[model samples]
Target: MQAGSPNTRQSSSPASKGGSARRRTPRSRNRAPQSPSAPKPSLFDQVGVTAVDPAPFDQLGLPKALVGELTKAGLTEAFPIQAATIPDALAGSDVLGRARTGSGKTLAFGLPMLADLHGTSARPLHPRALVLVPTRELATQVTDSLKPMAKALGLYVREIVGGMSFARQADMLRRGVDLVVATPGRLNDHVRQGTCVLSAVERTALDEADQMADMGFLPQIRELLNHVPAGGQRLLFSATLDGDVDRLVREYMSDPVVHSLTPSAASVDSMDHHQLDIAAEDKHDVLARIAARDGRTILFVRTKHNADRLTRKLRSVGVHAGALHGGKAQNARTRILEEFRRGSTTALVATNVAARGIHVDDVSLVVHVEPPADPKDYLHRAGRTARAGATGTVVTLVTDDQRRAFRAMAGKAGVKPTATKVSPQGANLARLTGAREPSGVAVVEPKAETNRNPGSGGTRRGNPRGRTGAPRNGGGPRGEAKRGEAKRGARRA
Candidate 1:
């Protein structure tokens, strides 16, 4: 690591820069590029590298101030991913890492980016480092996780995402930020408006790369990468590398250091997986029972409407719940996530779009209200719980008609859940998930969630009533006229 440090130099040299002591290291990996077609897909071998003992954060080539800040945060030791990738990343090698969600990928790449940027100065509209994520929620998360350590090193980190003040973002860029955490679309807007530039970015991290590819952001990502200077350090981390993500590696990265701690498709051993076969009639009662049990639980649904519908049902049944979806305004998403993180909301009903890249601590249970569309969706949904080496349970609710399909999806995702036939009040359901009866009392949603503006334009289209209350100023995402018993009133089949 020290060998590569002396070769690290800013394009314009650090001393010539002024204002905001931001920092970054230049790219200098001497390893020859591997053949693009020869991606090492082995999971057990750790990509042919010798097993390394996890080290203390202070001993990982990061600056002492950063180490001190991390120790203060109660994070004295490096996670497997952080330890495996940090030396290569700090040495300015393009790194491709495949680690499970919540394995601390944020710090795996972030610390190196910050360490590289230490003692450097920022230029207006030219951030020294860039971290791109699939969604605004993820951008916020990365920014929050990195800011404290960056501050310790006298570095500035700013979040640039949509649904925030466009003017405020532009102003922050004009004033010079050291690092920018952003989503692709919003960052492109800033670049188009001439408020930000990538010429000075010494390190770029594409977090959750597979999700971005699945979301169809490759065009925007490629455009953004084109703007950064060639030979800049790159770190790409994802749970899986599908075809599109592979394209990104082949096209942009050179001689990348590969690290795979575990297989993407396999389920972690710490998690307990189960498949609950239930009649459609008893679905609501079983779901409510589980939500009312204990610990932080995330319920996954198929659509934005389903998320709100389930959230309303859970809340009315006396379970404090929140709906999380991409369609909701950015601030609304942030508020709900904060509540869930702080335990104010015991259950979070979410769609696939809104839940990706979310990392909440101590989420003890994950329930799939509906079978996911594909194997990948199933894996990602189950990943919400059992994160960062914590033990948790994943339960998938499957009706008689859905069992075969669910089984097939699970098989492709490399999951073998213990199958059980369970009813609403069955002992099996209660024992496996700690299911119990809800209070059977209606809990009014925050006034903000009950209605929405017609202009917002979603399932709310063609509603008779005029837009009322706050003008969709980042309020709740639900729009239900009456509380009702459940999504369809717990219909008997």
Candidate 2:
């Protein structure tokens, strides 16, 4: 069952409530009052249809081969969002869906687009369908998921995003592609370069529309949409459908069938929230301890510099950690993500860049080293964990000065966390993070060597030895000199 559904209650005990209640004080009077209100029912809920008893995928009239592929992937049943919108999308109707992250929205639109283009021929540089995402990581992931299915149906899928080679993407487009998954910025670049054309697009899907709006890509989105064929089908999916997202829907989607599975804040239900009150000095140690735990953890920082700094600190204490932010090149970002995925790196120190697009499984913990600027960001950061019905914990480290501001932010985000004071070795810390003594061995990263003498007749130059003819910092007595001497001896011989 999906988290926050009517049938499933949050995993909260009476003792937990009592503990949080005791933390309340006169300061609560200054805080904004939370209304005793539930999320308004969606159009689907009012019609008496529910996501609890979704129809089978095969019964939705998907091709038998597609059904076989899904079954092979162990996806015999359809999630609520998929079941509700796939049929309408398959029938060429515009669809506006409101579903939380990890609710199987990808396949809801992907399968339909693929099936619709089953026998269609692709023209060079013009795709038949397009799926626009907000980030490079998301573009890569969405393509990965749909590529196999597209191949089964004799269709080709390619992803175009920034930070990758434009020449290579242009070459691919020149070769011919049926489905183009892209981000708005890069896709616009392709359009201006005349390498990609959307005039032939018969269908379009915008995944995470709300995120695109939040990131200020709506103008580009609007411009891109204006280029598509006038009567093509459009599918827009988002976690919430207000503000700029609603405006996009009204202006773009024509008589779209709306399917909203859960409230915007309901994704937090499967998560256990905690506010750790700690001194500023103890914050790094506490975070390092958490990163050293046995499960996958994503640590959210406020800045790119802090992401890198925290990653280094965690690694110094024997936690396998990596940093992810927009400042890194695409290849580095991809490598860090792969390392995290394959368990080589257990902890990911990241900014908000990874908050919305990343979909790694078994992420058991999410730590907010710094509170986000707003409640929406807080919810998105917390949504990183506790995904797809998996249980996880979200801990926000609030210093004394930040307590009041953070408490109000959490309240606005509809989160009531268990607030407690924590120390370097407190019981609550140990209980939450499986804390133990950190390894004292410091990790040193190897620096890239530059070739000072590139055209010197095959003579290789290494780093110069220190004043005493030894490697720096007692790395080993005369290690560099010994290597140089050996090379000299070999040359003389």
Candidate 3:
């Protein structure tokens, strides 16, 4: 969730559209017909596979630096959304992309931003590309995605969000930035304060447009766009484009090229869904067993307290799980996310916090330990799985009492999860899940202390440069002195 937002939007899950029944193919009866010694297809035959058809960078005419950065980050291959939208985005034309979350939308817009932006000796703090996200974590994550590519292109990216120190964000802006990834509310704050200007913005992207509308940010989003030039390129990407999002597209985008990957409701069809019936008393044990069999698992609960409590229970049972909810401090939220991304934590026991904007690779499963109130929440929760075309599993742990609500959520999301009884130890979890023991557990040694500091760079020792710590003798640190002196020194120079 974005920080300081009072009213949370109920999710619009696809289950109500009646697609769930098709996904509940039982494991026992799911075996395919045996082929008589037919040869398997080569790597090239796979669509959306690692085999390259036309690279996004190549087709989009992006700078070599951006492609190099993506290659270094193991993203040489483009997802379908990236391939479909990059060409138009790079061509400086408006684009409307319909793709589910985790479909590589960041790069679809980011690559072109890096390519088209012209850096100056007098760097403009004003953004060349403005990416409006729905959540603060997403702002940070999108900024992270832009950083390497920006650095490779000798550009700078800034993050503007709420809950973080405004002074810090202002300082980043003062230093000058090439691109800005921001949430609507905070971005509006900066705009109203004159800390940011959109006059120079040549490209703008509204990611998760449906979610933003659902969150009631459409007015703020429109207010933001009012500051940008009408002639500038606009890109809107979302899972479903209805209501306000469609209006935004019509109002802002001009002759935009449209790319829809699939029907939004069917996006999760590639994912495996399961409904586990576990006794209330055995819930913790079954969750631990399922979490233990994972690559990375995101477990969802209904309440902030449950999110925190379950996190501890998972940890006590020897599963590395972290908690995320609105109750956590910003620093703690960032740390838990870093732990999950770095593989230090195999599972994240979260409320609706991870429902959006937290992206890590190889997240193979999502478990809804508690049913959400509505279908939109279910869609956002289920969106955690089946990311970037990677197959994943979503299991909802439902007791008899919660069956009706679970069924309702499933119906709205159009997913029929396989129903099974989970024994106390999750005896049937492995077979039902088709998950082998997580690969790194054997090779990864346990650490004595948990490295939960986000700025620590996943190291036991805090920031190697000691930037995150206070200065000695109530004085500024080395970098701080230089930073403080730069403005003064520049005037003299």
Each prediction's TM-score against the native?
0.84, 0.81, 0.74
Tens-digit lDDT string for candidate 3 (111-218): 766777745421445777789987778888999888888888788888876545555666677787778888887677667666678877767889888888777788
- Of 1 and 3, the candidate ahead on lDDT is 1
Q: Rate the local accuracy (lDDT) of all candidates.
A: 0.76, 0.74, 0.66
Order the candidate numbers by TM-score, best to worst.
1, 2, 3
lDDT of 2 at 486: 47
**Candidate number of the best TM-score:** 1
lDDT of 3 at 7: 17
In model 2, pairs of residues that clash are none
Ranking by lDDT: 1, 2, 3
Q: Which is the better candidate, 1 or 2, if ranked by lDDT?
A: 1
Error in Å for residue 64 of model 2 = 1.1
Model 2: per-residue Cα lDDT over 81-152, one tens digit each: 887777667765677777778888889899988888888778899998999998888999999999889888
In the predicted model 1, the residue pairs found to clash are: 23-117, 23-118, 24-116, 24-117, 25-116
Please write out the lDDT profile of model 1 over residues 1-493, one tens digit for every residue: 1121212311212223222222223223433456879775422233533244677887677788999999899999998788777877876677788777888999999998898898887999999899999877888889999999999999999998755656667778889899999888778767766778999987899999888887777888888998987668788987776778877876777656677766766445678889999999999999999999889999999877888889888988899999887656665678889999999998999987555788889999999999886888887778888888888999999999998988888888888899999998899999999998999887777756323323222111342122234533333443221211122111100
Runs of candidate 3 exceeding 4 Å displacement = 1-56, 119-125, 292-294, 433-493
Index of the highest-lDDT prediction: 1
